[model samples]
Target: MSGRRTTHEDAHDPAPTWTPRLGDLAHDSSADRTGVVVEVPGDGVFSYHLRPERGGADPEWTAPADGSTLSPADD
Candidate 1:
């Protein structure tokens, strides 16, 4: 077998287990912010588009789809 260790083996904590979907409320732990999933990355896209949940001044931002920092927002 290849000697290279996997990510889970090297990580001090387990990686997150969530994926964002269109219209789903998501939390960006890296940014410490929560927003609505406005758009999900498509064939050529590599990021997720999120908008403020309460129509605030925050501009829509894109988050990586790596599934390590985003999780479903708490209700």
Candidate 2:
């Protein structure tokens, strides 16, 4: 086998150091939904999930991205 590692081999790597907390507001432009951080799976940053701000169905899991796209929603 080659000395270089493959993408699949990196899957087990640790998650980012930062994670969103519960009640934090997040915005997903692709979904056009601004939701509140409802759960953090403790697996990693990507495991963080959110719920719709207006209240509705269960929140969906989302990938962790730079905070530039997400900010605390106004009260």
**Best by the TM-score measure:** 1
TM-score of 2: 0.46
TM-score of each: 0.71, 0.46
lDDT of 1 by residue, 1-75 (tens): 988677865667665577788899988988888999987878978889889888778888888867567889999
**Error at 22, model 2, angstroms:** 0.6
Model 2 segments more than 4 A misplaced = 1-19, 41-46, 57-59, 65-69
Which residue pairs collide in model 1, if any?
none
Task: Give the CA lDDT, 0 to 100, for residue 48 in model 2.
Answer: 54
Local error of candidate 1 at 50, Å?
Answer: 0.4
lDDT of 2 at 63: 41
| Tens digit of per-residue lDDT, candidate 2, span 1-75 | 878765875777755544467888876555666888876656565455678787877556564544434555556
Candidate 1 steric clashes = 0
